[model samples]
Target: MRYVKLPKENIYEFLGRLKEYGTLYAPVKISEKFYDFREVDDVKKVEFHYNRTIMPPKKFFFLPREKLFEFSISKAEYKETIENVEPFVLFGLHACDIFGLKILDTVYLDEFPDKYYKVRREKGIIIGISCMPDEYCFCNLRETDFADDGFDLFLHELPDGWLVRVGTPIGHRIVDKNIKLFEEVTTQDVCNFRDLEKKRAEAFKYHEDWGNLRYLLELEMEHPIWNEQSELCLACGNCNTTCPTCRCYEVQDIPSLDGDTGYRERRWDSCQLRSHGLVAGNHNFRPTKKDRFMNRYLCKNSYNEKLGMSFCVGCGRCTYFCPAGISFVENLRRIMGIEDKSCPSEISEEIPKRGFAYASDVRGEDI
Candidate 1:
């Protein structure tokens, strides 16, 4: 690991230098107490200190809406056009958002590989920022506090300046090119960084332990708590849309004005929607809100066991964006029976072994 220190005043210069590569996206204050990642031309607009963005940075790779292909027909002949993605840099990403991107990598890259996604991801670079933990955050509970060996570069706040830790060779190249913006890190700097992380750990206590998650989700399928919790659920799908790890999608065929040519497009879908599981024969796998609610928990805790990673990155985007004030951490605590202040078993008997070689091949049945 390599470390560099950048003076706070020169931070914007560093960002401006980074803009030479491509579009630089960072968190910008959109309104009162709300921040969102957008293309940055002025580095001063980047809000690196925010608790979390209203939405995760997943849209840059997997767009909310994209044209998969465009086709034209002439005399019963059809031709298709595919768009090429451009390279860009994602700046000021939090650790939880980084974990979310890693989840997307496993999903889109492991499966029948999404070419569009792969192209966008390959062209992009991640610059993660270590942010102050908020009350809604429980990433440590999911064991995703650190950089997770994913980001190109990770930054930590310091008293005098910023501690830059380069994770990949690409990051090292950037550092080498912008050597003027950074100075050699000392042993004291490393110690100070570690101490800061330790303080952060103590400050943010885990709402629920990782070991209790399996058991908590196992027998809670039929619990009346779900009905009570989902009573005010608008099913607006805002939570799923904002969630970085939610990758459900729907495909549709759009015909040209001539009605002879069309292309299939895949857009992000939400499991919370009633039509998410609809079939051609008018059959829906999960018709009730309760079933959909339970399915999300199962996917996050039980079904994702095969991947050896929980689907929820603990970014708190779902909880933050929920209109009904439903809190995932709160629900998790209730499910684990932790409100009574009793320690639960470390391991659950229902915890399944990792299965399948690829995430795509691993199905709920396998779990």
Candidate 2:
């Protein structure tokens, strides 16, 4: 890992040069309090201090709606419709969002891989940035507040400039090609970086005893909290749409007027929706709101034993945008019979042995 300083004045120049690699997509302010990842037409439009984007960068890899393939009924010919797959760079991604992409990689790039997702993932370059936690942020508990990998280059904000960490060979190449734009890291810069980490850790307002979450979730499978949250849940699916890690999708075949030629399409789906579990003969696997609601959370906590992690990256998007006023942290406290605790700069180091493993255990550490 290499560290360097990027003067704030040269940020725009650096951003412009990054376009040489691919199309640059960064967080752009859409409204007074909302931000979204859009094409960086002008460097001035990018928002660095933004809390979170309305949608995660996962959209660039796994599109919301895409044509899988087109087929001819008469001739029985088929062709995969994956075009305009040019290389692209995702700039200013937060640590949690990058972890979300890693989760998607596990699902799409392992076992049976999705060719379309693989193509996009291969061409994508991830440049992460550091961020302070807001009231709704709890990635610290999930051990995703800081990322050690899964990014090409990561930038941490400093007073005089930004501290850049090169994580990959491509990241090293980017820094090497633009060596003039950066300065060597100094001793004070290193101390400031350590202080910044402490500041960010203390900034989180949402704290919880998450060590027992996995075990409690399994022990209380029939807990009343599920039923309680179900009544408030509108089945809106907003949480699923905004979540960086939610990957549920539905495939449909669109036919022409002749009913001979059509293309198969895949669009984002939500477990919160009633139609998600509906099948032929109208047999719904999850018929009630309680069942559907419970399924989503359970799916979030489901352990990926191969990867030694769960689906939730603790980005807080689901809780931040939930229309039903669902509080993820509070609900977890409710389940574990734990109460609200003030931010202490550190969470428990103990690891749970059941249900799901902590994010820090991604290297296969003993749970």
lDDT of 2 by residue, 138-238 (tens): 88877778888999999999888899999999999999999999999999999999999899988998655576577667766655577778999999999
For 1-367, candidate 1 gives per-residue lDDT tens digits of 8878887788889999988778888999999989999888778888978988877888988888777765666555444444566778999998888888888888889849888788888889999988778888888887777775788889898877789989999999999999988988878878889989988887675644566476557655555557877777788788889988888889888997778778878888998899997888999999888888878777776535434668887778888889899887777765665542222222222434221011212212222
Which pairs of residues collide in candidate 1?
Answer: none
Between which residue pairs do clashes occur in model 2? none
Best by lDDT: 2
Residue 206's C-alpha lDDT in candidate 2?
60
List TM-score per model, in order: 0.88, 0.91
lDDT for 157 in candidate 1 is 85
Q: Please give the lDDT score for candidate 1.
A: 0.78
